[model samples]
Target: MTEDQVLDEFRAAEALLEGHFILSSGLRSPRYLQCARVLMDPRRAARLTDALAATLPAELKIDAVVSPAMGGVIAGHEMGRSLGVPAMFLERPTGTFELRRGFRLEPGTRVLMMEDVVTTGLSSREAMKAIAAAGGTVVAAAALVDRSNGKAEFDVPFYPLIRLDVPSYAADALPPELAAIPAVKPGSRAIA
Candidate 1:
């Protein structure tokens, strides 16, 4: 799907938000994509994820789809279905991400780390580390939206359904317009 089409889904779901927002990365932005709202509808989630999965290189072989809990769970599950692989998730019950609930990967299982959005790529990196610790190899990663604007980097091939150029700023350097509005955190993770 085109970028406009992808964003249209978010608009139709009312997941595309606007306001002073604190992202999971601790940065502030005027726009935020509330993926939970978009994925709340299973059909929309499937459509979005299927388009995202299609963006991956055809040569990429994924044995399983492992996503970080909360945001990535639904997208990752749908991605697994799109790829015809088993889907599992990592949970941070005690701060650090780890595979639990009888989820295990073979020593060299090829994994596709999935996420709802990639802002700073911190969560994606953390989740990839946990996947490694659990004996899976994260050969590639995918996300529904990449609001990083080509700034966030990953160790593996990264594919995103849409790349949004939403501007984000550090807390101390927010634009005057955004600074005037009270910030609300709409992500799953807490900022320090």
Candidate 2:
């Protein structure tokens, strides 16, 4: 799908939006892309998954789709279905993402790590580590929206369906509109 088309769909789904948001990157932003809004629509979610699936090379065989839990679950499932692979999700346990609920990656399993949104790529990194520790080989990383604009660090090749170059503000760098808003740190691990 064209970039404009994808963005249009995002807007249509009211997923990409603006507000006081604490991104998963520990950065404060006035805008937030609530990906669940888009993923909630099966057809729209499939369209995005199809687009993301196109980026994978035919030679790179993916055994399963693994994503960090909460937001990435549905997207990962859809992507896995599109690629004809099994889907798994990692949930946080004691400040770290681990394969819980009897989920195990067989040795030498080729895994693709996915996220609903990529800001600092923290969750994706943790998911990669867990997969690696479980003896799974991470082939690539994918997300529905990559707000990092390619600045985020990752060992594997990162792929995002929609790259939004939206501006972000730190606690002190917040805009006047957000000046009165309560501060919330952004990071993959949200300490409730």
TM-score of each: 0.97, 0.91
Instruction: Rate residue 28 of model 1 by lDDT.
Output: 92
In angstroms, give how far residue 133 of model 2 lies from its true place.
1.0
Shift in Å, residue 69, candidate 2: 0.6
All candidates' lDDT scores? 0.93, 0.84
Query: C-alpha displacement of 7 in model 1, angstroms?
Result: 0.7
Q: Tens digit of lDDT per residue, candidate 2, span 32-148? A: 877888889999999999999998887779999999888899999999988999999988777777888988999999998988888877778888998898889998999988988
lDDT string for model 1 (118-158, tens) is 99899999999999999999999999998888988999999
Q: Best candidate per lDDT, number?
A: 1
